[model samples]
Target: MKIGKIPPDVLERLVFNRRGAPRREVLVGPAIGEDAAIIDLGGYYLAIHTDPISGSIKLLGYLAVYVPTNDIAVRGIPPMWLSIALLFPPETDETLLDEVTKQIDLAAREVNVAIVGGHTEVTSAVGRPVAIATAIGVGRRYISTSGAKPGDVVFMTKSAGQETASILATDFENEALKKGINKEVLDRAKELAKAVSVLREALALADLATSMHDPTEGGIANGLAEIAYASGVSIEVDPSKVIVYREVEELCSAFGIDPLETLSSGVLLATLPPDSVQEAEERLKKLGIPYSQIGRVTPVATSL
Candidate 1:
């Protein structure tokens, strides 16, 4: 199973309902892919989002950080604190737990966010390890999944399916060490896996943006479909400009899987004005982040 689906009962028990302190400055809350629930305190607003990593345990810590934090960053929120919850099977080892914690800390460090309080537990309810993180941030402008507008350029960071590529590479290396795929290729794949976080670019784009979407599940194509359908705008993507990493291409070919259709955790998408596109390209360059002009937003019935 993919290990994701908000069950109606669980949703009603945990996510759909909440008891909170009195509110006034709340800006964004309880919205999909919103990352963080934003509460504006006048001078600065707080952005918070929660996420759990289950099936992709190999990169649990990585997704635990970016997937949730990116929510706030896309809305122009800079992460301030992260609260984590880790649940694992009864047989979960201490060493594995330590490694997961280390990865989480490293992810936070990479984005200059702090890991605050959290909970950890081992139970029979699960057969493997799973982690959830609630990321909080500060911002002035608020952006959500429904933030796109007609005529905004839809730009994405990294090629699609970087994470899936890494997985295939790892799986392949274990299976093909006896085959002919070279160590250099395998090493590069690991690097690509670790390079999935997009906090910097997301925050930068939020400074002046229409909307942002991270291509996670279903790659860029599926993500574009979600944005267009959600915001009621049409999108057109140029396959040539979409940047899929060289190693990911090779890996996908090896697995007989379509990289464009796989799940990519590290990809970031932004919709901005056409005029600022060039400057944005330079900014991505300076960050050492690869991107592409894959598509544009237009007024239409649905996403192309």
Candidate 2:
């Protein structure tokens, strides 16, 4: 078992195959690469995403909200509500709980989402605090990860490993410092964590994108592979064109972690029809979000 996500084979063989029952309302249930589940809501589609914060403690509350919310946003929807659960170690105190709640409150307020309901408790089963969130959003029209068409252009927002770099610097500061990662570099990586949410950018390109996915757990390479797998299309990504920050490279090199397979919560991977590429680029530019054309969708499924 890995610290990140369950491997695809295990999910397919054990979980996906044993889903309890079939429902007419579930337009999208469990599937590889599809982050949020969509359900028919009469006039609109309800997109739901549930994710947990496990690896880093630096911004646990904040990450809890954004990580799951990112999935809903990529489905062409803005997360308007959330239900959260916070689990704390037995030795944790009230002050720490209050601070975490404060953090969650602040982030929820910033995104205009209400913390509708949730539970909090201290348990001896866990060593540290972990936050889990289930975000709900509604969209009139939504895009799917499996909608990528052949000849569609693949695109990415921001650099890969933004979350991984930030977490490494904050959680393993001593190790990073010993490895000659400068104070300024570490600070920059920490700062990058605040910009993890892709709600605004996702909304901007929602209409133009044929498919969208947030690269978490498995990073950019896996994210691209998912797009290909879900859509049944082959992706040819130019490794050189995929942006990997120097700081990320240095940090990952020092830690012996694969940045491409690490947790990357902020980056968005999208595919667009050739005719809509110009509009997508323009919208991203207008939003001041840096983007790059990594590759194109091919007719045949191939290696990432």
Candidate 3:
């Protein structure tokens, strides 16, 4: 525990000062904790966001870029460019850095986005190498977390704890096998970890969505809290219908963790039009994506 929290005055002093300027071309400027910004050009509205790697290192830089990219997609946008803020510990190796850069490049290529500019530094301030990427993209009619309607069908594109299970397995392979995780499960874990990008299905449903969000650091439960809070609706997870891998459930039980609370990547939650739900699921199936309908967003419930 922290001995003393940073006082408000000290917290303000410790932060970087933003350059304040109002340019007509800049629709959104430097703001505290605003994950993404927006800019309006003559014919398009561009949404931008950036985030860093903190938890897992196997594909740290790669996942760093996509986490925010998923934000763009969830809001019905297509990511087109990237500007990265990569910080590394002083003892970092050039070869490891190269591998990280290659992963970033390959991932961006898979989504066909250009790497813009940002800072790269090796510093004592950073304990682990951190990759912070700022992504910019275009949108037509953007979906917001606040857009979920009371009756919108709550839909998911993949299982709960997909990335979390995969990351834990990769990070604790030896320990996991002793606990009964097999080759098949391990392979499945790696496959899920490798499945970080969440833009494809999101962009496909962009026009049809009223609201959406990527299930990331805080998992589906946290995601539900946000959507419910923002849209003023209540969502219930039919625990029976939530598709968590059996091994993932076992792993969570072994560690005394809630599978619902584990970080989930490669999944998107959409508050889709009731008329469009089946069509959207079919679209995801046609694209070879795995998905399941878990629940519905009912009118704000008094019971909860």
Q: Which of the numbered candidates is closest to the native, going by highest lDDT?
A: 2
Supply candidate 3's per-residue lDDT for 235: 84
What's the C-alpha lDDT at position 48 in model 3? 82
Span of 10 residues, lowest total lDDT, candidate 2: 295-304
lDDT of 3 by residue, 2-87 (tens): 43223334545564244456669765443322235667777788888777666676677678667878877776778888888888
Q: List the residue pairs that clash in candidate 3.
A: none
Top TM-score prediction, candidate number? 2
Which regions in candidate 2 have their CA more than 4 angstroms from the true location? 301-304
For residues 24-90, what per-residue lDDT tens digits would candidate 2 score against the true structure?
Answer: 9999989999989999999899999899887777688788888888999999999999999899999
What is the clash tally of candidate 3?
Answer: 0
Which window of 10 residues has the lowest lDDT sum in candidate 3? 1-10
Error of 1 at 204 (Å): 1.9
- Write the residue-wise lDDT of candidate 1 on 1-304 in tens digits: 2354454357568875684765677755654343456677888777777777674666677768877776667667777788999998988788888878888888889888898889999989888788888988766667776777888888888878788877656645766455455677777877886777777898777766787876676677777876776577888888888888777787777777688877777788788888888888888899988888888898886445
CA lDDT of each prediction against the hidden true structure: 0.75, 0.88, 0.75
Kindly give the number of clashing pairs for every candidate.
4, 0, 0
Structural similarity to truth (TM-score) of each candidate: 0.85, 0.96, 0.85
* TM-score-superior candidate, 1 or 2: 2
As for lDDT, the candidate ahead, 2 or 3, is 2
